[model samples]
Target: MLTPTTASPRLKLATAPLMLLIGGFVSLQSLINGELASRLGTGLRASVAAAVSSFGSGLVLLTLFVLLHPGSRRQVATLGRRLREGTLPPWMVIGGLAGGLFVASQGITTPTLGVALFIVCVVAGQSVMALVVDHRGWGPSGQTAVSAPRLFGAVLAVAAAVLVGLQAGLDPAGAGLGLLLALLPLVAGAGTSVQQGLNGRVAAQVGPWATTWNNFVVGTTGLLVFWLVTFALPGQLTAPPRDWWLYTGGLFGIAFIALSTVMVRIHGVLVLGLWAVAGQVIAAVVIDLVVAPEQLGVLSFVAAGLTLVGVVGAMTLRARGVR
Candidate 1:
């Protein structure tokens, strides 16, 4: 039987920090994957290659775990039975396809739109969709009415992302092409809320490990198909470099997804997304400070601060509403 989505206070306290940490992992994964993509090849095809590598490597790792761990194997079997019985919706398993789209969009749009604009568009889509997903009870946590604070948090989260990249300035070189490409990440980001909700539903039935494995399976297959379609495109697939760190993106993704699968069932998608934004902002700031101190700006710190403020405000306000 599935566990209830309502979490105890203790669980809330424990999970919040974990969600933030998982968000940091997400930031790290993006860094690693972007580096990998830049190094492995060029053009959109190379982006697909990096994405495929991330998903495929994660799939292999999860596959090994399923083979070795009896508990995970049983959970997978149980989920299969539930699906066969029609107790679980089959559509939920396809959440990973959204993940595939999200990564692919990063490759397709970032060069044209610039990371600043892309992040803003993506965060905007994610924040808005998260509100709808939570309010409509699409996730395992059930319906959470959209309160003023929650709404504010969503807006603030987007603002924080925008603030972080304020100094970077959006590129206007390919305005027409960038606008079209921008839609890809916008839609893809919205899909992530759906992905989180679906993963939570699946995790409620089986477990996070099994749910994460299932995501990797679907995501890997989708990315593989994407790669094949782009195979004949005009781009060169450079041989994999010997740098070991480039290959760790998938491992980071595995951790992030598994942790998020568990956390989303407790906090709902909006709050979870806010917390994640906070973590990502903080981690990015830290990375900048360490890797290139000269480029770091005061606005980056301010953006990180605003993300935390948004998260805390939302949490406090939502808790009162529940009471």
Candidate 2:
């Protein structure tokens, strides 16, 4: 009863810009997460709690939207049938767990490392994992063999990540531990990337709205379950600050996830991932320069330049089909 979906040219064209926008949302999240972590200071646990709260709020809003919108109701029913028939892959479900972990890691690490450093670390993880996933063609979209150009791009991305890391002012003693924690989200991000690819394929078979809602439904459920078990202790899962700005961040987070899901359907993971990283780098630089001027040293600029060059270079190579 399930059929594959295909993106029209217009949709494909839209993916690039949309991915870039999603990257901006991600950058905002970095700033917001760092601020929250600094205030809470419970380390990784606090980040986990924040992730739970943010996602939990998004889930509630999405549920309300589904109830209010007559069209969404139909989409949900259709998706339910797909779920019943086992049309969606199990691995895609696992993507939800990865998403939750990524959020928690961001909340914990961003304050210590700063947005620039945190993003680079996660991007390093994402680039390498994305290469492996693409090369193996292991996910829902089938294998899109890694060409030579793609491999080169991955190398460049890694180099960029390294440059950014070196400039991040990380303590040598804590670097190992920090890097390990950072990888949790990176791994989770890669899973989500793959999940997006698979979901894209399934979305084409179903409808985009259905695919988006299904992911939200599944991912939200996963987040809530993990949240309840992990942070049910006293004083955990408390509300964020009373400021409207904090809640604004939550709204942006919801929009970011929703839009990125749509982007994955059009651009494929490679483009989506690359553009998202690029946007984050730009945003982090701006934030650093404005919010924490001391962090924007000469090395930061150099590293940022190197990262931009690498991203551009990789993109050029991809365009030319060198990989």
Candidate 3:
């Protein structure tokens, strides 16, 4: 009974909300990863061990999906050809190494730093690098100039991260060092996000399913290699906890990879990344207040509120084409 025009609009209306919902889900899943890392840090396992195991699980899951899904094989082959043709940059593989480092850092430091501080540090690093990445358009998609709105959003996100750090009671000297180390993963994540955005832009040409599978495959392989070289040596890595909850971090990673691809399609990578950071900050605040009241103070809330306002304003400007 529905005409094509009406159906298309209706579909868009339905899909926009769904995309936002998925974004929220991705954020919550990230928070869960933070929690899992904190818990697992108490165990003997190296953070790299958890990261490797999670990536291994994700590789298996994606491989299974590709095998069972009829059209995925063709898509994978086509994507491989595209990569060979140089449509996908070789540097993306480095992004996977970054991912491994991030997981390891989270596992090693999250307990000492707490979720709120960790998220803030990570977001700060990500936003600063994201600005550079987005401005340069260093991914599969051709370059899109960075706009003012995007810059404003990045600043706000950084401010929010700073506020979170201040709440962590870190001495100036120690905070400086922690912030520096945190930037490593943040820069890596920004690269990953750019790649994701580029992938979304080309999704219609190169099947999304195929692209997703290829990323996981490459990322997993890279992480596996890292594990072998750095942590898999005897006495270097600890065994992972046998409990099911420890595995939640890996499950969250799988969900994030898939949902983030969908989000990049609906929201520009910059906006999606900002919102994701916002969500994590919100969760981090709640976690800190409940678990570590010493980290909660007046300045933290004020900075958080200001950062939120800035993010919202930036998003509004973006919607108005003022970016």
Q: Best TM-score goes to which candidate?
A: 1
Worst 10-residue lDDT window for candidate 1 reads: 111-120
Point out where model 3 deviates above 4 Å: 1-45, 83-89, 92-94, 139-141, 164-177, 180-185, 197-205, 229-239, 267-271, 291-303
lDDT of 1 by residue, 35-153 (tens): 67778788778998988888889899999999999999999998899899999889988999998887777666554444434454566567778889888998887998776776876
lDDT of 2 by residue, 1-323 (tens): 21113667766665567777787787787677667655553544566666766566666777787889888788778766776789854554444555666666667766655666666666666767767776676555677777665566567656756665555436688777655655554565666556655666666566655666666556667766765665555334344576656545556667886777656656665666677778877887787778877756665666666666667777787778675
Output the TM-score of candidate 1. Answer: 0.81
- What is the lDDT of every predicted structure here? 0.74, 0.65, 0.60
* Per-prediction TM-score to the true structure, in the order listed: 0.81, 0.81, 0.77
What's the lDDT of the predicted structure labeled candidate 1? 0.74
Please state every model's RMSD to the true fold in angstroms.
3.8, 4.2, 4.4
RMSD of 1: 3.8
Judge candidate 2 at residue 251 and give its lDDT: 68
Which of 1 and 2 is the better model by TM-score?
A: 1
> What is candidate 3's local distance difference test score?
0.60
Question: Where is model 3 poorest over a 10-residue stretch in terms of lDDT?
Answer: 1-10
lDDT (Cα) of model 2: 0.65
